[model samples]
Target: MNLSLFILLSLFGTILSALIAFISAKGQGHRAVMILLALSTGVGALSSALFLLSGQTQLIVLQSAWLFGTPFVFTTLSALFFFLLNTVACLASVYAIKYVEQYAEIYNVRILDALMAIFVFGMQGVLLSGTPFGFLFFWEVMSLSSFFLVMADKEAASVRSALFYLIMTHLGAGAILAGFMILSGESNFESFTRLAVLAQNLPPATLFGVFLLFLFGFGSKAGLVPFHVWLPEAHPQAPSHISALMSGVMLKMALYGFLVMVFGVLPAAGTTASLIVIALGLLSALYGVIYAVLERDVKRVLAFSSIENMGIIFTMVGVAMFTQAQGLSDFSHVAIGAALLFAVAHAFFKSGLFLGAGVMVHAAHSRSLEVMGGIAKRMPAFSGAMLVLALSAAALPPFSAFMAEWVFIQNIVSNLATMQPLVQGVLVLVLAMMALVGGLALFAMVKFFGIGFLAEPRSEHVAHAHAPELTISLPIYLLAACSVAIGLCAPWILKTMHFAELTNTVQWHTDFALTNTTLNPFALFALLLVVFGLVFIARRASSNIQNERSYHTWDCGQPITSGMEYTATAFSAPIRFFSHMITRTKKQVIATPVLATNKWIASRTFSLGLRQIWYDGLYVPIQNTCLWISTQVRKIQNGVIQFYIALIFIALVVTLTIAL
Candidate 1:
């Protein structure tokens, strides 16, 4: 009946289904287990929404000495995050029905199903945990389980990506653990409820340190810049539904953690900390977008764009914090509330878009956008879903993403009027960066749609590939529908999202009514429909009036080849070239022409590969250093048992002498 009970039941259901799935390791056991798991998640989402919207202080507390602290507490925020978690889990569960068929051929379906259940449960624990300690325990559980999931493929690249993800996430967890410990020290208390007291007692420096720690820890998870290296590798390597969950919900879990820890717990965080956050956010937004615009790997492009969005959300939060510190609680609430709404909107559209991309990839047998075209005609459902998703992602008018971005930018502009001169200068940069990222995002989305869906097929494989299964397309459609609904009815939805309470900005009015102009998203949608209808009619009329003939795609009467078509790499080439100073694209061309009797008969080909900043910048040097270090350390692991015993005895003697 209560939210806590609902969450526990959902987790329990996963565990039960996992066991059943394991027991019935043959036949249709995986499907059955997945169905039950999906049902539990659906129930969890529904109940969580009920709990959060109920607006009652439904505290589910229990004192436990399992760790160094007492753990217990659940409020509206935890409920909100759990709702998101379960919703995504349910969608992903259904998707796995067909998505995991590729894996089932290699691994036991039952084992994978069991792991999937455990993975969802671990995420629930992370979201539902009341105390920092409880949160950490579940965080590790989530990370470890996810690590195993990433390594499920065990291909060389899979192994590498999984290893990178594991190391980075655990490193992030360590920082989070340290942050919690520091906050715990300041509190001199073990309970999350007592965090407010610690916030009041701790000095500014300690608060700032804790903030940075949490930033690195959770920012890594959220795939914020500098800490975002693991995401591009991890997301692309994981299975599709897993990628959807990771990008959509798991990243948001970290974001929820950051917000809960900072805004919920640290009541004393002020201007300086907020400014630092905003500055970092601006950099992330700029950097993420620039790289995203240049990426040819479709999933990687999406992944980088996520960094851009997260940066925008963080910037909004920073503005909210800054405004709150300046005693403008009304503006602060408006800003932070808008950011939270954006987070939700982003989750809906991004998940749907990624899943849609997954469907396309499966159908086309390629992740390269260059190879795909005319898919909108081939797979209408998937293409339409992707179109809506891409539009939303571009922050087009009336879409939920647009509404959120508008609210955020409006809040920033409003604050510029009253901010200090120095703060005003930074606000300019933030607003400008947001604008720039939005434009780049538009370009990127256009590229995705134009190259991958609308034009004629660029390759034989894509021309011949069929539509994705209904199972894949259906979930994406549902999510895209939610995006449209939310966009069309934003004001009504914002009424329920009480941002004022979250930021402790009680002075802000919860009734966010717009003045000066009517903002009707429904009107915008209708207008778009009409405009498109007229265009379609005109095109139809022209086809009847004019010569309507199809021919080879203006190839100058030369025989066409896949290379002659616009490749994804070539499409992004202009941006890549422009941003070469930043993106550092490395190009290699191998031109070996086919020859007949010592005369060149055919022109050679050109191949392109993008440079990884991390590889040349960090990984290669670290790898080489480690190799060199290993060579030195190899002397110690000599194949002699007697020598090893002697070395251990010598170390023991050294320890004894040191103790003496």
Candidate 2:
């Protein structure tokens, strides 16, 4: 089949699905619409995979012009991202079938289904867009659709979260616009191909300025540290399926923008830019994981974990940028490949984790880990799937995340010998930071899984928790399976990605043993399977010889209560104490009198609070300054026409003088 024809059909399918969903919103056909949306997404994914496998590297320009008379370009890179976007969309849609049923009465189910379809469409448009104008148009569509999705609950908090997200998104978009306008300049070339040539002739200072603009622009959307305040607030407010998409693929769209700007447009951006990227990525990774470990809210923990994973991805991207600047194409290939691999792995596992969180939240009637416990016995399937996802997020062996990180570490260490002493020292620090981030990630996941699912129920809600329906559980299971499959098939997946062509490196080894890498997940997985089999056989044999007995544990002559169980807050207490400076943790204790005549304490109340250093120290000051300036400007608005005219005349005169 023709590549363009396949893309066109997929696009039509998505649009048709959205239309049908809108039409069916007020009726009993919501489920059917959702199923159709999933089917459409699956078709898109298949088309994208076929395009990539066909080795269609040449850009296919859409004959029909989009907004601003700009065409869309479908290249191998775009096809790869399209595959990822559609694959996740398909899973989210499937999960939403049962998940949204709970909200069917409270919210507009039709709007939710329609927005999901449109969101996927907008993402596809962004990837395929050939010009800045077209990309920005679709970018706004994607952002707005998600904003409404975040505000779907219509609670005061969700509304506030949506507004926060809206502001940050536009700020990022404005930066991108400014950078693109600067690139276009007098010629005003709309096509990226033309802009690439124009960008090469720009002065060093001008190029660096453009790079900074794109960094802040794309970085904000990517949830890089100072600009990341909106993420934790916004993600948890959205419906769980939407949250999965936002964390899984929406952030990756920002990453797609970054890659295009840095590699495609400003290939000449040198070591200084690369160093800055590396530094920011390192800081975000460390900061994110530390907060994840300290967080008590279930969705908030997952939100922060997304930030940490983004940091790891950006760190690998920085390594690729550095290698490319130094003309080390081989190392650059491996670094960028690792980033893409991690991205795909993260999409699968993180989406699964968020879906599982939704089920837990529904079962426990809350999003707090403090309220949840001992759900594994009731929700065995969910517990097992969530465990797989948590381990993957923790970057343990026999998972795709571990393989990607392993590849990243290998490249960083291998390239150190060829660098200057100062560069080598920086690389060593980066390596150490990566190790620390991985350890903290494991700690956070353990807190997430162990607190939310393992022990006795901490509240009445959790005590009677039930498993989610098959419709919801199916998607989680599929995603978990993908995470494992990707790891075991790492070598073939790497080869098929065509990193060799992109970085001018040799074809990767095609052995199931992963012969050229430090560790082989396939071999490790087989070994683990054999070990489990042996242990199971031994246990069975022992059981046959002697009858098994079950007994309740003695509580040391005292009755135990759920209150004695370790809460999520208590689990993370030590980490919070050590990182108090960064976390800005505060505690309060209040004592109440038992009687008016006596000073005897009746009860004590304790509470803990965590603060964002960036929000308080950086953004708050900027916000206050803006408010102060606005207040001063308001003083001039005295409802006088003469005063407004005089101000306008003075502004025109100043503009004329500057123009002359």
Candidate 3:
């Protein structure tokens, strides 16, 4: 099959799915439409996977014109991302079939379905596009579609979040456009191929400027720190399945743009620009995980964790850029491969985690971890799936994330030996940061799972929680299975991805061996499985030998209460204590008098608040300045037509004098 025809078929399927969803909005066939949408997305996913794995590297021009061309470039990099977008889209659609039912009463079901299809379509377009015009067009489509989805709840909070997302995303798009126009010049060559050829002749200063523009532009969308305020706000406000897609796949679109601009368009800026990227990535990794540890909202914790993972990905990209600049092409490829592998791994586990969060939220009627406990007993299937995803997020072995992170660490360790002492010292610091991020990630996930799924119920809502239907559970199960399978078979999967073929600087003795080090994930996974089996059998035998007994948990000297159980806040209290300077935590306690005669206190209330340092320190000042400037400008608005005419005449005279 021709690659262009294959891509066109996938596009058609997505568009048709959107049309069907739009028409089905006014009818009672929403479930049926969603299933159809899932099937359509499945077809698209299959097609993309086939195209990517087929080892085809030809550029397929779907349409061409004088000003711009619509071409699909099938590089190893683009193909990998295309596969990521389509795979996540398919699974998210399936998950939403039942997940969106709860929102049907609160939102327009048809609009939700239609927007989802359009979002996937726009993401695919961004990955497949070979021209700046097409890229920006699809980029806006993706952003707008997601914005509407974030606003699906029609609440004041969702509206505010949507507006923030809209403003930040467009700001990024504007920066990207400015960089592209500067590069296009009078020739107006819109194609990336042409831009790449022209980039070689650009001066160093111009290339560096373009690099800065792209870093800020793409970094905003990628949820890099400082520009990342919208992410935690928007992801939690959006519907859960949409949250899954946004965090799982949509964030990678910005990565796609970075890869195109930095590696494809302006390779000359690699050495200088990479240091800045590494710094930003380190900050994001540490800052994001710190917040995740303190977050009490289940979805908000996942949102912050997404930022941490994005930081890890950006770090891998920086490693790639830095090694390539230093003329170590093999090490560069290893870093790039690690980034790609981690991306695929993240999409699977993170989507599953978000869907599991949806299950918890729907069952408990709250996103607050403080309100949930002992949910594993009520929703075993969902909790089990959540446990798998949580372990993967913690970078445990026999999970996809562990494999990726191991490869990343291996790349860093391999390169440290050959670099200068200063560079080696910097790498050591990066390694420590990565380790710190991992430890904090584990701490956060344990809090999430333990507080939300274990011990006594914290609230009446959680006590009545139940498992979701098969429709929702099925997707979570599939994603969990994929995470484990991908990790266990990573060597073969990497080989099938033509991972080695993506670079030519070095040759490997085997699929899993990088230079001297060999990774047998399957062997490690099997050993863990055997150990788990032995423990399970031993527990079962011990239980059979002894008589079963049940009793209430012992309290020290009084009756036990749910309050005695560890709360999410208490779990993170130590972290807050140590990091108070950065987290800016505030606590308040107020006592009320019950009896006027004795002036005795009846009850006390304790409150805790966490401030966003960037939002408070940076955006607030800018926002206030803008408001003041707007107020001053309003003073010039007068009702009198004569005053306006006089002002215009003076402005015209000034313009004429400057022109002369």
Using lDDT as the measure, name the better of candidate 1 and candidate 3: 3
**lDDT per residue as tens, model 3, 1-660:** 666676677778788878887876363666776676677667667766776668665446366562255675566567777777777777777788778877678878888888988999899889878789888989999999999999998999999999999999999999999888878776674688677777778888888888888998999999999899999999999988899999999999999789778766775446668888888998998899999999999999999999999999998888778767777666777777778788898999998899889988887789999989989988887888889999999999979998888877876776688887756876788899999999999999999999999998888888887778788888899889989988887777666666423223233223333323566888888898899999999999878555777778878779887898999999999999899899997679888878766667467899887899999999999999999999999888968899899999999999999999
Return the lDDT, model 2, position 471: 88
Tens-place lDDT digits, model 2, residues 1-660 = 766776777777787878988887383667787777788778778988887777666556475754777676776667778888888888888899888988777678888888888888899899988888889989999999999999998999999999989999999999999999898888765788677788878899998999999999999999998789999999999999999999999999999889888877875558889888888898889999999999988999999999999999998888778767777666766777888889989999998899898998988889999998898988898899899999999999899899888887876776689887766776798899999999999999999999999878888888887888888999999999999998888877876755323312323222312337657778899999999999999988778555657765567888777788888889998898888878997679888878878777467899876888998899889989999999999999999999999999999999999999
- TM-score per candidate: 0.89, 0.94, 0.93
Superposed model 1: Cα runs more than 4 Å off: 1-4, 61-73, 186-189, 499-509, 513-517, 534-564, 587-607, 618-660
lDDT, residue 283, model 3:
92
Which runs of model 2 end up more than 4 angstroms from their true locations? 25-27, 59-61, 499-515, 543-546, 586-606, 651-660
Q: What C-alpha root-mean-square deviation, in Å, does candidate 1 show against the real structure?
A: 4.1
Best candidate, lDDT-wise?
2
lDDT of each: 0.77, 0.85, 0.83
Rank ordering of all candidates by lDDT, starting from the highest? 2, 3, 1
